[model samples]
Structure formats: C-alpha cells, structure tokens
Target: MAHQGFPRGLRILTAGEYRHVFDNASFKVHGKGLLALACPNTLGHARVGLVFSKKNVRRAVDRNRLKRLTRESIRLGQHRLPAVDIVVLSKRGAGELDNDTVQRQLHGMWRRLEQEAKRHLAATQSIA
Candidate 1:
C-alpha cells in the first residue's frame, strides 16, 4: 500500500500560497456545494488548500467535518492527480450534504481537476 499522507509541503499553509492559486487559477469548477480552483504547478506533485467559511457553514463542528472530508478525499486521490495547486472552498449548502455525498462530489471534482490541469499544462507547454 502507498503512503497516503497529507504532508506539510503538500498543504498550502501560507496565505500567499492560497492567494496564488486563487488569483492565478487555471481552472475552476463547482459542485453541489463546493468550489474548486486549480493552477498547474512545477512541483511534480499536487498540493491542496481548503476553505470552510463561517458564513458558509455556521457551526464550527460542521466546518471541521468538511475540512476533514476534503483532506481525506484529496489524500486518497492525490497520487493520480496532476501537478497542480488546488484550493477547495465550501459554499452555503455544503454543510447540508451527507458524508457520502460530500465525498462523491469531492472525488468527482478531483477527477475534473486532473483533466483540466492536463489540458492546461499541455497548452502552456505548446506555447512556450
């Protein structure tokens, strides 16, 4: 079995890092109650940042739950993902979704990011 750990380097720990993804995103996608923003990276591996706002999810417990779900989903699928910096933001309805639904949505979103990042990278390489 592969080590599926969310290491510090694989996390967007700084505000600047998160801002970079948000400001220079290559692709953005929306699902049930989640929004995913992605930007291709030169790191050769994927990194992730998550946002669960108090305005979107009123309860602290709900926010933590969403973050845990997001991190777990990313950890499981990180190996198959392209080299990209991804930021996932929760919306108002995200708290209402069940664990299974959140996981399913997150999985689908990661898959979409994979496809989009591939295309974006190819296009950039062709131009350079």
Candidate 2:
C-alpha cells in the first residue's frame, strides 16, 4: 500500500512530551536530510516531534522554519510508517532549502522510515 501523510493524531507537544520521544534515538540518512527516530510507545497512536535545534543551525527563525518543514513533510508522508514516536532533526543547510526541495528530501526520508518501521514491526511481532 502507498504511504499517506501524517495524521493529526500523531503530533507531540510540551517539554515533558518532547523528552518522552527524544529519550532514545536512531540515526539514519536519506537523500539530503537526516532522520532521527525515537520509538516510545504511546497510549493509542504515535506522536512525532521534529527538532531543529538552534545549536545545530543557529538563529531562532531558521530553527523554527526547519522544524515546520520537517513537521509538514512528515505529515505529508506518514502512511507507510508504523505507530512510532519519531523526531526528525535537521543538519546544516536544512533551513536554506526551498519548500519544494525540502519536500523532496522529506519524501526520501519517508521511504527509509517506512522500511525501518517494517523491520521494527517484524521484531515486535517476533517478541510477542
């Protein structure tokens, strides 16, 4: 089946909530962006929070813009992903890219994320 974008039910907020998903992270590379993931199980569905830290990119506006881009991209391509508490952090120049460019990069990241989720689901099923 084809992947659909992230749904409203999969959004994470608050400092405490952020820590919940950021506790443990996995590092992956896809296209021009870096995909960071944290798989903390939630009550019903997954909540995702994308972080573009100021320390990594510098400037508040840039950080916010990149975060917005990452969130939208995830929302636009969350179908293939399983229930995951994910966080996608931007590297250098992520803020410099245009919306179209960011979209393309995010699409590629989603592909990797889909594969990762499949692996995770398989492992989980084995455990159960």
Candidate 3:
C-alpha cells in the first residue's frame, strides 16, 4: 500500500488545537535525549509542528532544515501513531544540530509515541 501522510481526516489545524496539545498532555518520552508527548486529536489524521528557536540556532536556514528533518522523521513514523493530530516542536538545540541528528532525535521520539499509542489501543480493546 502507498504511504499516506497526514491525511486530511486527521489534521488538527487551529491555534486552539495546538494549545490544547500543550495544555492537557504530559510528556511521555524523555531521555539522555529528546522528549515526546501526544495529545489525541478530536480531529481526524495526525499533524506535526516543529518549533526552531532563532535564539538557539541563529540561522534561518538551519532552523528550516531542522524542521524539514523533523517532518521526514514523522512521515516515516506516521503509521505507528494513533489517528490523532500531532505537533513536533524543535528545541533551541535543534537548529544547532545537523539534519542527521535531528532525524535521529525525532525518530526516537516517534518510537515512544508508537509504543504509547499501542498501549492505549490495547487498553481500549480490552475494555470494549
């Protein structure tokens, strides 16, 4: 089957949606590394957001590159996530890092997200 990325049915596209993710969810993935958090979207498919702060990286080119890497990581990992919207923010260190570094960090976070979603799915299945 072809890979479906960020399907229309699963996008959370509003400021309110982003704020809700930040406000209600607790971070799930933290390590000698990156952190991951997921807030199930009332909206349909999963979305992603990357925040690269200029204060940390200083170069617009670097910031955008980091964002691109983050997106690719999510695209590769999309199937593992729940049918919810998502936003992946880039920390200050993001811009300073290379694309490979950002990609590794993001995929690591996505792995945790996948595991958590699996657990949630199992709980739902058992309850139903």
Candidate 4:
C-alpha cells in the first residue's frame, strides 16, 4: 500500500520557503475563515504551509486543530493538485467553528485550489 502520512516532503519547512510563496503567490482561494495562497512550483507535487496565529485562533488547542484539519485535507487531495506551493492562513473567526464546519470549508477550498492550479498550468503551457 502507498504510504499514507504527512511526510516531510509534503511540508514547506523553512522561513524562506514560506516567504517565497508569500511573495510570489500566483493565485488565491478564499473561503469562510480561511484563505490560501498558491504559486506554481517545479517539484512535481504539491507542498503545503500553514499560518494559524494566536491573534486569530487565540488558543493553542484551536490552532492545533486547524493545522490537523488542513494537513489531512491536503494529504487526501494532494494527488489531484498540480505542483504548487500553498500557504493556508486563518482568519479571526476560524477558531469558533466546529470541526465539521471547518472540514467542509477546507474541502471546498481544496477543490477550488485544484481548479485554479489546473487553469494556471494550462495557461503557462500555452504561453511557453
């Protein structure tokens, strides 16, 4: 069976890596309580970064929960995504949502991101 884990390879692990995506985001997918910035990459697979600040989430428990949900959402949907670096940021109201609500919003965001990435890839290919 294929390994089903959030391995290091799928994570954006450094300040510089996160900065690169923040500085050069090609597109954004916005959902209730969350916003995702994405830029195409050459890595042949998707990588994810997350930003859940204390200012937004207010509690460590809530922050952790958001991270878990985001990671799982990415893990399950990564194969359908194009090669891009994505950073998911939390908004002030995210911490108040129930798990089911958060998951539903996350799933929708992933679907939107995937569609956006496909269009970006197609456009770049045509331009090349």
Residue-by-residue lDDT tens digits, candidate 2, 9-87: 7777677866766675543545564556666465545577777766667778877777677777666565555567777
Greater-lDDT candidate between 3 and 4:
4
Clashes of 1: 0
Give the distance in Å from residue 24's predicted Cα in candidate 4 to where it truly belongs. Answer: 0.3
Best by lDDT: 4
Collision count for each candidate, in order: 0, 3, 8, 0
Q: What shift in Å separates residue 128 of candidate 2 from its native position after superposition?
A: 3.7
Query: What TM-score would each prediction reach against the true structure?
Result: 0.90, 0.70, 0.73, 0.92
Full-model lDDT, candidate 2 = 0.68
Q: Which scores greater on lDDT, model 1 or model 4?
A: 4
The parts of candidate 1 lying over 4 Å away from their true place are 1-5
- Top TM-score prediction, candidate number: 4
Clashing pairs in 2: 4-79, 5-76, 6-75
The digit string of per-residue lDDT tens for model 1 on 35-119 reads 9998878898888898899999988888999999998987765538888888999988788999999988988888887788778
RMSD of 4: 1.9
Model 1 lDDT, full chain set: 0.87
